[model samples]
Target: MTGLAAASLAVSIAVAGAGVPAQAAETRRAPATATAQVFAVDWVSLGIAVAGYLFSGGGGGGGLQAAIAEIKAAIEQSKTEIIAQIDAIAAAEVEACLEAHTIEFLNIDFMDEYTLRAWAQNATSCATQASAFAGAVQSPQAVDKIGFVIGPIFAIVLAARAQAGFINGTDLVLQSQIRAYEAVVTKLTPTDCQLIVTSEGSAFYEKWWRCTAYNGDVGRSSPCFGRNCLPNRAMAETQATLNTSRPVANGALPRLRAALP
Candidate 1:
């Protein structure tokens, strides 16, 4: 998503989902499955952005000195957790490929982040077992302080476009990718995490986290979507979730938005 979109989303719902503004209700409706997933990913990136926002010594209430330790710990802990499943998938794919081929490798090496399984007789070339793994595994993008901070906003904007039908979600492969991301973000974050916006109004989108009043009055908005849906964050979030799918994981669409165009 573009920075402009992210700016719009962040501005909209910097608060909580269930407590989002009422303005969104007038114009924007809930988005489709594909669009909602984009919001999910944007939140992850936003978590990092929230930390960055804290860094400039701004945003949130507690002083930076007081929260710095906790914030860093959260980021560090989250970082370890974020990469585990991806690595597991890559490892399993490599093992399965070797087993199926009945190939015995003497040694494995990396080139441009791709795996090269070498044997005495023949060598295997890897852009990694899958290109999905290549970008993620090869010199995995270090969590840049700036990019990590700004990325969420960028993603949210792109997602807003998708939610608004500016981006197409007809591709089945892309939908699967969305599902997997949904799974990962949910799994890595607190189990009590709540999604303000959802497609089908299933339990999946129910409020689990405490709702705080953002641009709108705290207790006024609906559990699914507030009265206004606040244009920037909540609006975008609600719009993104309007018509989302139940995340299904087949690894078809593993590439993140940055990894894409």
Candidate 2:
């Protein structure tokens, strides 16, 4: 039993035995006079009956002793139950933080799928348990112990990690675009304009004459006569991609070059 509970019970037992003879109290190793106090234990009357029995030499402190012991046991049991309930609540909050935010943040890159999944699961467990003690304090004081929320410290951590991952993905897309442009640039050599500009229908253009190269072809022609075409093949191809909303094929570069001026 807690010290407070034990002290309270002792006071009650003493009160019930107040009427016992001073000699009897002394024989029992109790104080000579009972304090003018009433114990809160409702069963104190039963203890008083036991005190009467004590005076009669039948039973003295046995019944009240039993009652005090029972009270102490009940108090201890109540304490245990309350603590268990709080622990359950704390565990629930930690799980919420893991599921609601931590896992999602780690899922940004599929390349990191296995590694991130493993790391996130482990980190969540560690962070959650670490936050458990915070539950004992007010929520504001123990920010991490609370459930997942966009504005909380946990959410901030998630955002920071996600941004870092996003930067990597951005770099990859940029590098691919740079490589595609470089490939087209390497293939485009300087072409001399033909002696005559003739209108020829190209395969990729409806009015092929408008898009036909400067050098030599006349109406809806497919083959190029020489290295005679637009100045910027790569930029035109990239723009075509922007217009069509997809990657421009390498084979289409020759046709796209014809359209570029």
Candidate 3:
């Protein structure tokens, strides 16, 4: 018999044994002898056997349904747990990216007071010129107000754009994790699921460590060793090579936006 058929038969027999009602008559029967064959068969024994078969069939069906329900519940729980972990990871990744970008900005002299003031003045001059050009087509006072707003707004936009780049990088890493997690879920095997989760965790740690190492290389190679020095220069060249090697995906922005709260 097939495995499923055998399992069904076993369940039926077990249920029959458990639910059998007591009977007064000797229900056990043997193959009839030529003399005994002439006598009539017992109708009561036939009824009992039919009843047992029906009861066993019903119990087996119930058992199969219970098994199915259990499997479904397990899958649902696993999905929920995996998604929760992904969300937490995504949040942490965003925070890390912001922190990294902040540090990168701090390292750049343009983020310092003197350089910042110079940039602000340059941005203000550009805004004033653009406004004057637009004034020919709109209200002069309105254009002047717009220019006034643009000075500070432009600085804010620059800072925001810098932050966005880091956030975008974080989104790429999160997308990788999501894809890996989905692959595990699709396989729906215990071992594959465990491996995927473990691999994702390892990847996260490795990326963070690599970023930290890059920062350290930047620090060691700065000022005393001078610009375009060994390690920092090499690191920049290596990153540029990696960027070229990877395929660019334009749709990543929308994916990252959806992940946001």
Candidate 4:
């Protein structure tokens, strides 16, 4: 009977100790569950932050690309507009110069028919003088005999007409060069235009002075001043102006091309 009682008492103590341990385990598990939930929330927050950062970076990059494209387009448009303006100016200048030169050439007076006939007759006289001198073998100088008989009349009419033609042609070509320079200046900025005008004007005046000086010599008589002198002079002047203006024109072409789109 005592053994039975003792066993019952021990069983009660064991039951009480098991209840305390079970309560302690419940308390630990509750804290562990709360800690796990907090960790999950922290992970979710970190993922959200990273996603937001990526979205923002992409948005910024796209905006930057769009802005750059707009700027480039604007620059291209500006270049095209500028180039067109310049070309129009060039065309007008060319036309004006051409008209001036054409008028000058057309208005030139030629030697009259009577004068031409008289000059022809002088050539015949020269032939006769040459034949007579050749036959004499005492050889009267052909030049001296011809000059004594016919050179003066030919010189007065033919030479005067020739000289007039030369001066007229030179003026025509110079006018053309002026027109070309004007056209180039038209494309430039007002400031650039002023520079071009000054440069071209200087070149024109220099060539004009030289041409006048050259033509002043009695020996330099021809429609183009004994050669292609006037045309050559005008060409030189045009080239000089081009040398100054071409870089600016060429630099603008790429921008103009880009702007077309």
Report residue 34 deviation for candidate 1 (angstroms): 24
Task: Tell me the deviation in Å of residue 242 in model 3.
Answer: 44
TM-score of each: 0.19, 0.16, 0.15, 0.14
Q: Global CA lDDT of candidate 3, please?
A: 0.25
Show the colliding residue pairs in model 3.
none
Give the residue spans of candidate 4 off by over 4 A.
Answer: 1-184, 187-235, 242-247, 250-261
- The regions of model 1 sitting more than 4 angstroms off are 1-75, 91-261
lDDT of 2 by residue, 1-261 (tens): 122223323322333332332222111222112111111122222222222222233322444344334433322323332222223334565544444443344343453656654554444344434334333333321221121111122222322223232222222222222333233232221132223334455433211112222212222223334335433333333322221101122322232233221
Model 1 has a clash total of 22
Better of 1 and 4 by TM-score: 1
Candidate 2 local accuracy as lDDT? 0.29
lDDT by residue (1-261, candidate 1, tens digit) is: 333222322322222243333232211222332222222333333322323332333433333222223323332333332232223342565434423222222111122222221221121212112323322432222111111112222222222222222223223222333433444223222222234554444434432123222212122123544433432333333322222221111111233333233
Q: Against the true structure, what is every candidate's RMSD?
A: 18.0, 38.4, 34.7, 48.5
> 2 or 3, which is superior by lDDT?
2
Ordering by TM-score: 1, 2, 3, 4
- Looking at model 2, the pairs that clash are 194-215, 199-218, 199-219, 200-218, 200-219, 200-220, 201-219, 201-220
TM-score of 1: 0.19
Top-down lDDT ranking: 2, 1, 3, 4
Candidate 2 vs candidate 4: which has greater lDDT? 2
Better of 1 and 4 by lDDT: 1
